[model samples]
Target: MTTIRMVGFDADDTLWRSEDYFAAAQSTFESIVGAYVGDDARTTERLYAIEKANLAVFGYGVKGMALSMVEAAIEITESRISSSDLQRIVQMAKEMLRHPVDLLPGVREAVEQVAADYPVVLVTKGDLFHQEAKVRDSGLSHLFRRIEIVSEKDVPTYRRLLEEFAIPPEGFVMVGNSLRSDIAPVLELGGWGVHVPYHLTWEHERQADIPADAARRLRSLTHADELPGALRAIAAG
Candidate 1:
């Protein structure tokens, strides 16, 4: 195995607080709409369905999520949802956009340590403006050599990233929370992938279990600070 010379980080849950906001927003949305239907479960399921359906049109972001909430509310109530409640859903989206960027535990120390030794890149996917805002506000912006806010995370995207950075896959390492978006692609490209499990993964980012052989190319850490040691072990192997 080649020594990894470049490290890539995933921005959302991997670096800072993200999904929790969505989860919170969902709760708020349900409370606002729950009065009409009185069934939080149905509304929740409907919201997820609307989000999935709108992904192609809205892509991924808080704005799209707001739209989905409105659509779900209208659908659940048969368009009987009040205009004021609709406005509340819009307000929820605004709140999410203005939400603070809270970095996960040890993100700063680990990122700084890796930046001192190798080039670090932030490879993240989502609405361009929101993702950029999170990175800019996260206070870890200066630690990365470059930032790539992509629409998708797949094999070709990683290949292009490797080429753009002028690094071979064998010499690159990706640390992220989602196996589907962050880990699997880099592993398929023959790079080292370090999985750091997150508590609340977005449904769309979930995938089947990785093959045994591929899973062996990676290590799982419970926290961000453990990343430096994991990378060192990979290099040592």
Candidate 2:
């Protein structure tokens, strides 16, 4: 019988405070560049463009963001951006890397409870160093049987994870906030996806709309503590 033998988690916004830092950093970047570019909206748009363009090359993380910000600033300022201004951009990334990891509400309780029943693993994508650092700092690492910090999270990635762990897709459930990164890929692979929405979402991670069937799999929980019940429902299904 197919059952949830392994539960996979997306580490960023789903588990802790991640996008919040990126949002704050973007605001800082916009302010710095807007001073020279004269229009905050246009500057932000340009930075977004640069970031999207760099995603394939840099994958994702503060370092990529910092490089994109520098490139955007230089272009927006027409090469007039000062050395100090450039340093500020680098500092923004540094602060983000150094920022403390704060686990989201009920994360500890949910992970603890779920770990007691099912072997849970962290399947996250980002800069290896930063993601690993956050997992270590969050103090939730011990709850997971293993950790996967990949360059991207897609159908292939999910398939690979299942193969490595020797778990069938039907016997796995993925829990996360981003539909694009976390939920969609798993659903496409025939695995269950439980989406826990976060208030702040990065524009890049946003998807147009989840499919009707995929939407049905979602469990709208007020907090992570409700994850065990959701998993039980998925298992029973």
**lDDT for every model?**
0.89, 0.87
Per residue, candidate 2 scores C-alpha lDDT tens digits across 1-237 of 347889999999889988988989888878887787777448878888999999999989999999999999999899989999999989889999999999898999999999999999999988999988999999999999999999999889898889999998878889998889998888877778888889999888897356777675666666788899988877777
Expressed as tens digits, the lDDT of each residue in 72-117 for candidate 1 is: 9898888888999999999989988999899998999999998998
Candidate 2 is scored at a TM of 0.95
Best by lDDT: 1
| Model 2 per-residue lDDT at 184 | 86
Worst 10 residues of 1 by lDDT: 207-216
**Runs of candidate 1 exceeding 4 Å displacement:** none
Q: Measured by TM-score, how close is model 1 to the native structure?
A: 0.95
